[model samples]
Target: MRDNIILACQTCKHRNYTSTKNKKTLPQKLELKKYCPFCREHTLHKETK
Candidate 1:
């Protein structure tokens, strides 16, 4: 099934975006470097519960 997840900024702890992933395929939380307007720089974003 498809699961909805939120990507939050690691530094500012802001919810930046939302994306969906297949639960059966990716059972782990997602992480990536994304641009944050609040931080004004690229930061590591982690999946939020």
Candidate 2:
């Protein structure tokens, strides 16, 4: 099954579509500095609860 997850940018309200099948999983945890197209820069983000 395809997994659809939401990745929200902490810097701006930029939401990215991430698929578990396509995205690279970090060994430790999610990366802080992610590419944010809305902010036009690399911003930080945390997983939504």
Tens digit per residue, CA lDDT, model 1, 1-49: 8989999999999999899999899988999899999999999999998
Clashing pairs in model 1, backbone N/Cα/C closer than 3 A:
none
Put down candidate 2 lDDT per residue, 7-41, tens digits, no spaces.
67887756663534333554333445687777787
TM-score per prediction, in order, is: 0.93, 0.50
Against the true structure, whose lDDT is highest?
1
Candidate 2: where is the Cα deviation over 4 Å?
Answer: 1-4, 19-31
Tell me which residue pairs clash in candidate 2: none
